[model samples]
Target: MTQPPPPPPNQPPGPPPGDPQGGFGAPQDPPPGGFGAPTPPPQQPYGYPQQQPGQPQYGYPQQQPPTQPQYGYPQQPPTQPQYGYPQQQPPGQPPYGYPTQPQYAQTPPPSGGKKLSAQAQIIIAAVVAVALIVGGGIWYASSGGGEEKNDTAGATSGASQGKGGGNGVGGNGKEKAPANPQAKLAFQLPQPKVQDITDVSGSWLTDKAYVKTGVDSIVGYDLDKGAAAWTLALPGQVCGASRHVTADNKTAVLFEATKRVGPRFYQPCTEVGVIDLTAGKLVWSKSVTGGSAGDTKARFSEVTLSGTTVAAGGTDGGAAFDVANGNPRWSPKPNAQDCYDMGYGGGAGLVAARKCGPYDSQYVVIQNLNPLTGAPVSQFKMPPGVKYASIVSTKPLVVAADVGDTAGDGSGISDFFSIDEKTGKLKAKITADADRYAARCRSTEVESCTKVLVGNGRIYVPTEEHEGSSGEYGDETNEIVSFDLATGKPMTGKADAGDKYTLVPLRMDGGNLIAYKIPPYDKGGQVVSIDGGTMQATTLMENPSDDSVRDAENSFGTDYAEILYGNGRMFISDTMLSKPRASSSTKEYLALAFTTH
Candidate 1:
């Protein structure tokens, strides 16, 4: 049987390490200025680099998120109040009261329940104060509703923690001034030959793109112009199915399985191949058989690539290979506990969960290797009580841990910490107030939320929660929570999801954050950017393409909205058109790409 999805590279596969069965309870009153309360400006945590005097503070505005009109999605006035902001009009749309659209279904809460922050009273007071200050005037703008007058709600009242740039956003319900101009679409492209989009990655160094098409082909595209440069195909029949494919500027690694014919029963074989993009050829392919020689069908359950190391693991054990040449480098002993749930540490090398002592003693081990050779250069473990949860990278190696149960969100809290790559020493630690577990799961359904990314020296977390108390159609929350990359403290404010938008962060472009926004039950999605520092957002494109395309649905009825960032550009594609297409040349399966810079 396949092992449960391993937590990020250094993390294990299980409910958080501290308390597996605990239920996250209702949110408690935040400490001083915790979750909902207004507090002093954040003091840079230990190990955080000092900010320059003129550096911008990265935080989300306290005002509720707004909505927008998307391509094909008719412009509709928002009737219900957004999570933290009052209802407002979108740009280019007629004045409010056009016609009310049917409400979409509510996103079910986690099966164990959810904790709405207990800051409702404080929010009400702030809102009332803003209404009074504005004299209850209706401010309008061509871009959308007027800039949120109370955008800085509760940001500045707290005493300055240390020598910093400006007064924090007003804390005592005072309104802070608006920021950067509204966002506009930069550009959009179309992809017609795409049957389905499997993957998309960009390489800034080469200014090239690697994309997996629905039909067994990987194409390289030019970064400047949206054109295919080269295409590679997976040859031969593969037995097992795996989704652990990755690409850098120079090479792409794909995982597949093949069947070995036998006189009695056919046995399965695992294969990992590397495609040299520049040469436009399958450079190398290797078979993986980690278990005993007698066992004919030794297959891997997991596959991942870090640097040049491709690691594959099964319940029995795991192994590593050099992606440049399909040569075996190392394999774990049969049934060895250390080999269980092995994973590639993203750009970091090999990662494994090792049992150190006799029983009940297991430590997550990270091995930074030369990649050229499977030899470890160094290793480290998290401080005690901290269980390995997930990892992002190795240099200044980033990892998240399940620290234990916190007062609120009984699912327990996770800490994203960094380790010194040179010495394997602890460098910094930031506590994730919102549990990754709680964030990834809804009711009994579990989704991957470990895609947390770092950009422009800041860490970001995506959160989706019920916005206002009203169960209205459009008040649900979907935005990103940012933290100091060094300190791991939640930034002063957060990025808001637009009223007509349900944006999910894809990756970071330079210092800016890139995300895909899906309209409520709509076919197409939009590309938007959030200022890395201020958490302000701009819609790069509304519809992205003019052609109508219904979102694709899996057997599970889950909608597929594909948006990827790589090679210094954002790769976006639409699902197949819901209705029959007139011809294949139609842009039903095209990718709309834009240069982030």
Candidate 2:
């Protein structure tokens, strides 16, 4: 009380007291949004005791719910900047409310009793000990603030860690599933047990695919390294064929030539598993069956060729087998049903689409046959439900899709006809938008007809809307159109559509058009690719419907175009023991190759 001058040990924080001109501390620029607005409750501190009508007072909870004028001095803002931005104000307060920083120039306390100056009373005891350490560091940071969902559930339940203004951290909770660019995404399928492993001659460049695994096995998915490099063990029984899909060198692994169908079973036919991506092995397998599997009127799916001579077509129809030894090398009198109908053909020879009603429905034949015996030598056509063929400008053309009937019940008017594989006739009949991508008839064969998609030269039908043409809204809308490759026609001139997308479980690629979405809990699938000369589509990946979306029709894409994509991976097959049976030339199938990236 009589000797007070012991203050100089460190002295850094100093600024308070009614000093006529001496406080200047830096951080004073606050008042603009600091302690602003809701601060009219101050003068009651002298005696501070007035709470009767509302008994529970100071501990606060009597009806204090209208908050949101916050900023008891900081800590607020955990992620609000979305709507056009600009609305954050709360330090010394006053952004849209005025005021501005470190202000307080209100000095006036030295009139009559003007006191000390040994440094002006040692600067009022260092400004009253720096306003008690700045009001005890603003009451220890507004007592660890509250309310914004218990400080965001205590910073995401990690028990408080992310400090600095607005905690609520991120990542470490494990969220991995976002990237899926896709170049072609393994053909988007899950419904194709075994549609030809190649041997009778669809000869897609050798591996031919399947080596055994109808119920499950003999897999192959390399889309640029996402995994499952190879799985060909054998013996379960479906089929294979992967000769030139792309992304690189292309590989095949076929097997199904055990003909005899009975007497201990054997006409499922086809077996040539070659791998050689650089010498992988299992390169030679040929069993093909004498008549090659054509007697009793015929039944082969496809295996075309003309140079090394392997031409097979079925329903007891197409033939020319001798890729060095499968032997028969000549057939068609059995009426190879016009070559190849429903799907798959272009291995170098067969075009197939023999519906033949309008005087041989545009004829579209393409059969130089005689690879050494298949013998037709010449039979070309192109405008009858064109054979679902692929191979741009290189010349091979055939397409066919129909649905016309004026409704006598044959699902009214729908069409597709492109021919001319070498003169059997009709070169180009691809109707503009072919009346809505047409398909819903009642009679027409190539396996009864309902799908057709050739490549870059253009052709991708799947439509239905003229059964009674319009009105009260209900054409059922199921389109997907395209055409126009060096003149087969229909790229839009009038069924005229672009970027419409929706084929239920549609498929077709030599560029891209995959489909299938919505079934049970969503097997997480959806693809897209449309660059057959910049038609440009591009959706490529959607995956994640779980457990491979119930095998989404065996996961399509032997060549839906852009070639191959990675991860968010795909492959699906179980076609009931390798489906492609004309009475069983060797059938047994199953395929799998999933992964969500």
Candidate 3:
């Protein structure tokens, strides 16, 4: 390198005599402005750092700062945005600039040099990666979206298998299923007869839930052929509950008026008129007593055949009824009783009633009956903190979780109890919960039951974790916790049905539980079948046709739609605006899922 001329021996050399051009890095005394002194004007931005006095200068070219592009680089968006922000646009007709696309020039061959070798290439690659990472972090800090936005949704996938020791029969026969399947849903829902329902609350006799014939009735589509069926109409509008057939398919009972909402409700007392579904004739009309306008009285809501006598519940909490021969059989009184959120076991001699009070206090009353005579033989009773209980036939069993302490946490204390059938006294108590206990049914409710279902080696209760619990913690996930029907312990590895819904009562067939899922009107939905024994799940039907929420007026209770399994054919109710003759007619349909073999 050639040397520049030195400063003469007269004055101090400017910039210590060896500074780069326009350099300001010089040793000097502190200014009067202590720390916040004005920074010296930017020196040669395109120049290298100046050398201090006595330091040798090397023959290096001054590197000019790269010009910022008219457009900049696009940074990757974040995995999840903390705050929603509008994307930036470039200078244009729009107010904000979209992010600029950054550009990098291809490395041109060095003057008179060949391409770099492999080792040199590796070093450059590492440096480039580090720079990109640092740049991405800076961009994320300023712009909010991080670099992981490239992949969204399903960040993790896993498999779940049936665990625990004994895999007893679920509502399905015992069988294990594939986990995390990589297949499509079996099939698509069929677009059936578009029945814009106004009210839909009729049970599925079998696996099918549809109605046929009448304007807004089962008229347009015939369930038998999967098409339109016959329509039957007399005169004024009829309601879904106006008349219903029995599970035996013997008679249809119509709910007469109590007040007029298009159809005048038979009030104070309404008549239970029975019309033979086979003959379609009004066989008999029996009117129960109703309260006078000035009284806060109760009356029958519906009637169910207990044995030969009709067992019924009142609008206000009571069960009483007249037999076929015009005799008052069993009467309902408030306990107030509860069904442990179980089946609407009322109607016959199985009415479970509850009288509830504050501080989790309750008096449960279940009417045990002469299943042969439809008369109450004895009333079963229970006190509060009785976690769960159920009845089979006239014999009732109560399940109370003895797990709570002063701190409200439980030791997972569980026990099963049998109450005397005739006296409602404790008969036998068995322990159910233990470390990793499989027999303890953690449910607060019990659903379907059968004679054989009760006698089987195990009985399954749909259990959920003690929610909002104060004691020992348990998984709050929904599970089918089975207990040995004989000994009462955990029995099987449960399965999740892939959906959550209100715990509704299920109709039972042997060990099989029959239930249906309905569409909420606005969207498509399905009906599912769960095998309690095999632990298998199947979608029997997806009726894109029925919409529950569309007809809000007629839908209130969990029994909004019914699923009953009996001698073969299923009779479903498809109803819409079953009233106000001259105007709009909402409709429903009944379909037979399969022919009776």
Q: What is the C-alpha lDDT of each candidate?
A: 0.38, 0.30, 0.29
- What's the TM-score of every candidate structure? 0.52, 0.24, 0.41
Per lDDT, the best of the predicted structures is: 1
Rate residue 107 of model 2 by lDDT: 18
Task: Order the candidates by TM-score, highest first.
Answer: 1, 3, 2
Query: Tens digits of per-residue lDDT for model 2 on 242-268?
Result: 222222222333455432333343445
Question: Alpha carbon lDDT of residue 478, candidate 3?
Answer: 30
Write the residue-wise lDDT of candidate 3 on 1-597 in tens digits.
Answer: 111121232232122111111100000000111011111222321111111111111111111111111111111111110111111111222111111111111122235546566666445434543443344344434432110000000000011112322244434222122232111121111223322323322222212223332332223233345453324332222332311233433222324343233233223334444333333344454543322211334344434433343444433433333334434433332221221212113221233433333336443344343433333333334423454343332223333333221112232224444444443333433333222222222122221121112213444444322222233333222333334433233333343333322122133333443333333334333333355555445544333333442243123222222333233322333323333344545433332332232
Error of 2 at 321 (Å): 5.4
Q: Compute the lDDT for candidate 2.
A: 0.30
Worst 10-residue stretch by lDDT in candidate 3? Answer: 23-32
CA shift of 172, model 1, Å: 35
